[model samples]
Target: VAGLPNNFVFAQTGTYTFTMVTDPNNQFAECNENNNTLVRHITVTNLPDMRILSQHIAPSKLNPEPGEPITMNVSYENIGQSNINQQMKLKLLIDNIPVDSVYPVNGLVTGGTTTVAIPASWSSSLVGIHVIRAIIDADDVVNEGNETNNEATRSFVVGSSANLFFNQFFASNNIPAPGDTIILTARIGNNGDLATEADVSFYYLNDQLDTLLIGTSAIAVPANDSITLTFPWKVINNSTVLAARITNASELEFTYDDNRATTLIGGPPQVTVVSAAACTGTDGGSMTAVVTGGKPPYTFSWSNNASSQTVNGAAGSYSVTVTDILNRTATASGVIADSNCCPPCTKAPKKPSLLISGMSSTGATNKFCPGDTIIVSVKIPDPTACSYSWTVPPGTVLLGGQGTDSIVLALDGNFAATSNIYASAINTCGTSAIGTGKLNRGAKPGTPGSITGIQDGLCDVSGVTYVIPTIGGLVYNWYFDTVNTATGAGIITSGQGTGMVTADFTSAWVKGVIHVTASNACGTSGARKMTNLKPAPGKPAGITGPSQVTAYQAGVQYSI
Candidate 1:
């Protein structure tokens, strides 16, 4: 063979010509002598060799949190024109001891290269820096071009989890009345490994259960520490409920329910006579004071000689007064007359109480699809003569019967995951309690954005780390381009399953797209880099030493 390795060995170091002949023993005859014999020039030297090219281990993160998984990858090649059919083992070692072994390489042919990756989990106790090693053909099963280049090692650090939570809330005055200002304070704690920034928000709801959005506050909280926030709320209604909520935290938390706290504040009180028996010719009359609003422990005083608000008197006139712990009082008086002269007289009727028994959807299975019409019918109060007003959700339109009890809503595509409707009835007396109905718009996910970061390393020597945008997702997948495969054939490696990745960018150095897909129970959203990979800056072309140098004695300064 012209270019094949010569297996024969010569005793002396010299150049020689070797001749080959067909049927040298004359056992067979050839048609022509010129074509039967072939001669080749040969040199007595070492044979071709096969070796391990290189190996690499990718640490998922520079400082990975405890319990996070890390991966190790090794790349090897057959440098010689010989196939490795012998049994060879690629062993993964920790501190030079084999921890895992990969099976025999059966058909590693010439110029062939392959990569082997192993995944390992980090324990909670695994802190500080640790070294990982990937050794190919560790037992020296097959002869190689270079025996010293079989193992590659890498180091990484693992830390604990960073968790932040809402701790407690305090109000300067819990029983603040309407038109009064109360200072509300909330506390946030970080029981985690690293420092983090927390996003905090405040909310308030009146006695009617109508929620109001207060402004949000952004604060920084160090690890294993806590901070308190304060907000001044001008009381608008009595019996108001206040809450402090924290969401979109920079650090991942083990639980989210503890991120909110609530407290209730008192308001002005209202008193009314719930029951009043009219005075008649045959019997006396009695009345009881019904009190609402304000704080509890109320007191009642009747205008009659009786100490209590409930009193019995002859057919003349009587009055009652009600008071609360806050000293707020209400008075009401009624006239009693003979039944023959007064024709069953009484006070005006009270407001009708509103209630929503049920809400239905026209779509399939009571679920509203995108662009579907949702019809909400409130419990209609009969001929009592009361007006109705509905609090519609954002982007909802009342089609008909707005002043009436029933209304229709045309659901638009921008409808959020949940839609709520509140109805309140009002008449001459007072406003009724709010009635509510709700509908679900199915599963949904928050919008995700893409980001990019360059890693420290050269194109040919070390891999570049891309800091993937971390969006809330049940699972994450990353895809990178190796060539012009931006659209069709570019996927070189993937299945990172994390928010960050370290890959060889040399293959797609100048032009590439890193596409990340985030998926959950709802669906998936794909994020792609807006532009090609940016080229790393080259090293400085020239360098020089310090121009001026001066030496000094003890206690004297030296300049360079």
Candidate 2:
């Protein structure tokens, strides 16, 4: 009652003053003080001191383009002896020339700071450096004590600014062979007085101008200087165009037209290739090529110098290079397996792909619960010729489909474990790479922590609060007399499906209990019971005052 306002009643009075309180030894503490009264004083200055504390221009920029609307925010303060309540005029000036001569200002409280705005936007024009000024009380409206600090000024430029563009593109091999290493150079230049940081993007393009951005390099372009960026590039086909550009130029840039340029490289002519594998009882193997496009009458050079349309070799890999009449060359290679690779002309199975639950399963994911059945499958080139074998995590049971490309597994419910389920595709020729899926044991929410609240709640009391340690993603349900006693407690008023609850107890409740359970998509946890709960006996009836005693009498006795 000492510090609480509007509470005038006091049981006993000696002296009191307020002090902050904290838990001492976490158990017991009391507040005490000893003063009969307190006093305070108030004072203020009478003269007002007005000044423009600070001002800022919105869309702050070095060189805002002509006709770009910009606003100014001016902060005026009354650091004075008295508060002003009447309207005052603030002025906005460009180059000390008032554009807005009478922008109105609402008054400020004593020692208070406030912001005001002009009703018009100022467009930066007339390309040159200019001054922006915010002057408060320029006409002596407030009769302020100090008049020197009524204005603030800032400077901005509308003239020369940072301008970067592509100067020229150069390459060591403009007429380069396909797949030849070409030294590419992109020259970036700046024409203004401001330096800028930019990125030079290089792209590989076809005659159709279809582009592939290969890479970019960070460059610092000095004002009035040119810098060359170099990168190693290769042409993929004839008429390949190499392009370079300056990306993310500063807003102060004059124009963007010259920021990018392209140069075309003439790629050399080439040929296509095809080869045959060795057969059981024929020439071991052969490589073949013919000029399809470009100059005809193509010539072939095999690794063994068997220069012709076709070359024969033993069971192995062979390299083939071809040159057209213009001597522009192309390279390729082929493999010739042993003549006995297959009796029926077939290849062994390739690596098989596996999935769980019809898709790739991330390792040890909790999305699947224990006792859940999962489908495991594999895909191979020729499923009809391949048989699969499966292995699962320990304690899991394989249901069926082990010899085929798919299998079913029953997750072990008795234990939660993380492991992979693997399968292999087998053919008469060879076995394929092992395909794998994974599983993690998921289950119902664990039993919740103890319920906490007043152990012996009063009978017939309403809105008593109880709470349990919260488990995220679990729904909690609370009930009274869940053990089925006649009147163990009363109704749960609110906070169902949450970690806390409030309830109203029955007047006759005794030896009651609070029961709570946590549940989720998996299942419900066992009930957590708060036992040994009983209401304190209703308070004893109040004593009655007897016949009234005379007023203004001292020591008069009354009987109960």
Candidate 3:
């Protein structure tokens, strides 16, 4: 059958008339001309349905870190009965805003699909629930079975941010005299995994706790690092509390409870704070003001520029002047001292020790087979600032972790059976005592020397006494090889771990071989064969030679 082909699409659901004319302009005259003139009505119920197959963030996670680079992966497919003859558009949206529009290079047929990836707009400051949407056939270029399922939306939150903290708040000069500038420094520490930027604001509080903003600084702090910001503050004004805080961080509200510190000015406030015991080492000593001799509402002024009752100062001599409400003044002097204020900060670190992985506890006995690599580490407290030294035995290769407490030792088949590993800890102060770790190598043992036994004992009824070179701490197992019409099951009578033994070979063939192996914690070695073992010769052939040779009868020897 043959027919003329034409391309057209019915957009509406209702059916319409269709007419065909053969050579309407007399372009061709054929035998089927009358049949081509016939008209037919066709129903257009099947339509193309373009739908979003999938839309998500690549390297998907429930919550990604702020400013983390990410891309949106989206795909669309035609799930309808009919194929689309024209290209369609795909639109991507972020938070309901159209950010990207793409077109299919070719028409989409039934079950045809395409995918696209778009880089997302991410910023360190944007930290919250976000939206990503993928819309297929956005231009409605292709007639579909359903249009409602053309888009997909996803929402995700930017992670738990880095923990930024104000670790240090101090000043260059706590007791600044008249016209002296106090350099205030704030140390910010990030204990989290994300870097962030923030503004650190400095302030000061007067005697009445009246606060004043000194200045603000914008700085960047990296993950697990710290940065210091400084601000020059002048005018002690008799005494005032100086402090700093991280108020704004990446345009996000920080959830730290202790983000702010106040009344942190250095040096003790004048007579306002009554002296207690002198402070010892670094901070942590407390003092309270017990003003009884002054008039009502007394005001204290300190050379350290402290308006509050308490302040911080290095170990040294301090003086302050106090005034009553009526303007009467008095002065006092005190000293802060500590023997440990600075003692060269001494003491050597503890000795280095080794710990093997998979062991129950440190210093536990372990076995290492031939061609085995073992992870040996210093079983000591971590985060300790120090170095280490390790010493390995002969025939052992140190794989790594040298010049440190831990190490990797590769023991070969010919490695020594027993040895010790020496190590030590070195610190700024001094080197620690050398430590020791034992190695019980399970290397293959060398073949035993030729079987040594008394010639007469070899055939004795009491069995033969055989021995091999004794290795201090290994177990020797002896066995016999099967031969002839029978076999000899050598019975070891004594000295198993002692390396010396007596075996009874009375029940088997003379052609059998006695083999022994050395074993330790690691495992057993290969066989060391001892051949020519047999019971004592049959009573020396009834002592025929001895009968002819009597005592003092020379030349009386005879053969049987």
Candidate 1 segments exceeding 4 Å error: 1-159, 267-274, 277-289, 294-560
Model 1, 132-248: lDDT tens per residue? 777777666554445566777765556754556768787798776678887888888887777777778888774345578877889888888998888887777556557788877
Q: Candidate 3: deviation at residue 373, Å? A: 86
Per-residue lDDT of candidate 3, residues 1-560 (tens digit): 22322235554344677787756887887766566576787655456677774333332453567777555667777777645546667777767877767766345677787666654544344776667778777866554557688887766557665667878788787556647887877778886666888878888765455677878889888878998788888755534556677866773322354467644333332343444443232332334344544333455455555544454444455566666543556666565443232223267767666676522111234656655567777887323324567788886788765554567788765667677888877655677888888877544455555556643334324435778776544567776675522443455544444456666545343545667787654566777776655554534554355544447766765564
Give the TM-score comparing model 3 with the true structure, all chains together.
0.23
Write down the worst ten-residue block by lDDT for model 1: 340-349
Residues 160-208 of candidate 2: C-alpha lDDT, one tens digit per residue: 7777888779788877777888888878889877888888888876434
Give every collision pair in model 1.
50-145, 238-267, 239-267, 485-490
Number of the candidate with higher lDDT, 1 or 3: 3
Q: After superposition, how far is residue 360 of candidate 2 from its true place, in Å?
A: 14
Backbone clashes, each candidate: 4, 1, 6
Query: lDDT value for candidate 1?
Result: 0.58
Candidate 3 clashes between residue pairs 3 or more apart in a chain or in different chains: 48-144, 239-305, 267-312, 459-535, 459-536, 460-536
RMSD of each: 36.5, 26.7, 38.1
| Top-lDDT candidate index | 2
Per lDDT, what order, best first? 2, 3, 1
